[model samples]
Target: MLLGTPAAPADAAESSLFRGTRQFPETALWNDSADPAELVRSIGFGAVGATCNPVIAYTAISKHLDEWAPRIARIAAENPTWGESQIGWRAVEELSIQAAKLLEPAFQASGGRNGRLSVQTDPRLHRDADALVEQAVRFSLLAENIIVKIPATAVGIRAIEEATYRGVSINVTVSFTVPQAVQAAEAIERGLDRRAADGLPEREFGSVVTIMGGRLDDWLKQVASTQRLLIEPGYLDWAGVAALKRAYAIFQERGYRARVLSAAFRNGLQWSELLGGDLVVSPPFDWQLRINENELPVVRRIDVPVDERIIAELSKISDFCRAYEPDGMTVEEFDDFGATRATLRQFLDADAQLDALVRDILIPAP
Candidate 1:
């Protein structure tokens, strides 16, 4: 298999030699009701997933607001046991289902390895652990290759446990810190263990740690300009080598089922530039396009062969998202409407324990 080959056709299987770039346009997957299959086919992306939040949902649903009025009215007439929330869920459900359907053939061809749709669980349920589990179960029923997008919240961990028990595949989304990542690995093992004990099928489960490349760099730059930017001096958890080293060591240790999914990837000495990576999830539209055209120029696999000393340093830091729970919080007490950014902010400010973990336990494995 040559390194450079023409992009595979829509109905074709993902190329063995070429790793597919997953694209999230920093916006909606489709606009003005763009045809899902046609758009996916045209993009040449081997797999594409939709990450919806309050904003994206509104953006996608807004286009059909007037158009859906008739549909809404019909639904209202047929089943009065509904509100705007129900309508919205149904609409998103249909869209997600259709998108999954479009990729159904490819998913089958790959034996569920690729060609799938990742629909995010409600952001409103980010903290409600039980709600997340319920949501995962519900969404799982909607599609076979569905990857229930769960936030890396404490509650999300519980959701992962429950959902995995129910035989649903989950993507631990928004994993920024090491402890959060370690906990994700722990949760995955626990889930896998439970599945094994229950005599459930051992499906290919994955725990991906999302290292926000540019976001972390940007945040670091912002913090570096501050006074207590003192998280520096001692160990290296924030920068290029330090971060990648931490990722590699853990992925190689405690969690074989857990893989490092380089996310929110920035351009610097990140994966493509200096540090060679085994796998990366692509989001930048322009770069992926350039990559497709062979226009990016230098796309070498960056493998930073670090020595044991570097490994020891990374083993020290504990985790990311100090405000979040190590095991994650249960999302049962909160309602969907009550889950807000302000609450997330509060948890973050309060979770000083986790911050210490990142600085202590989660840096790297010695």
Candidate 2:
């Protein structure tokens, strides 16, 4: 007797249902991975692009050094006098180019709207505007679809403006507040205007202000724990989502062209609440699978208000208050914000790790 074929998994059916609805028509799905295999998988799942940083690049390189060893060896040979950092930078650039080629089909299909790959400039140079600009321009040359990832620091803002003026697209990461997002968009517009004045086409370039969602909640949760504040279960979790919604509202009001990308999502709830806007939701591959498995509610929770008592309690902490404000922050304020400094430290740590890896590869055991 012949056996009947197995039925489709529940998660697959659920994913198909979500995909069919197209609830978030304006929002594009992007993969937040550095591995080319993972990038290909995301594309099959309808992700249009991928984001990369030193951490992701380091992980990818560490896992696939054999595949990359030939190019690394060649670069070392070609530039015998170059240091370890230079070699490491070249490795990341090459890996990013390979990932960009993989997503080129989506880039072409959207006619430059999607299929972009982001490669971040060195975090060590984040404080030096001129150096950041030089690095960003160099990374952009890796591919036409490459989006140079710049930190949202004061100096980073300047570098972003300069890079945009030079006709390079950007993805401003580590943005934590509405003010930071607005400032970054204004900087991009200024650069685009300068380009237009110089007779260059402005519409072809794109920019994104990546607001890290889950990290905000994590920060708030830690604060509450230290202060012995008894907060409602889900109240703190909504902090990031509320901030992003507020940022999107400001973007619309200003008619800014830069897209708002919600990243670092902690759970499916964050994804569900922030759906159906002109946003790009980029969670890790596992989070995407979680989002697809669950059936989303008919109505989203974008407009739900967090408790004022909770806000007031959080406002007692300076950083929390600054982050929760709907109005954008000043450049000076951005420098002092707790989240901004934390983000910079995180990037630097990742960069240091990449550097160590490069040194290990260059210097053999005695």
Using TM-score as the measure, which candidate wins? 2
Please give the CA lDDT of all the candidate structures: 0.49, 0.76
Backbone clash count for every predicted candidate, in the order shown: 25, 2
| lDDT (C-alpha) at residue 259 in model 1 | 55
Of candidate 1, the 10-residue stretch with the lowest lDDT total is: 24-33
Local error of candidate 1 at residue 253 (angstroms): 3.3
Error of 1 at 15 (Å): 14
The lDDT leader among the candidates is: 2
Give candidate 1 regions above 4 Å deviation.
1-43, 48-55, 62-81, 226-245, 265-280, 284-287, 290-294, 297-302, 305-366
Candidate 1: tens digits of C-alpha lDDT, residues 163-244: 7777777666655544455666677778888989989887664334444444444444444445244343423333433454
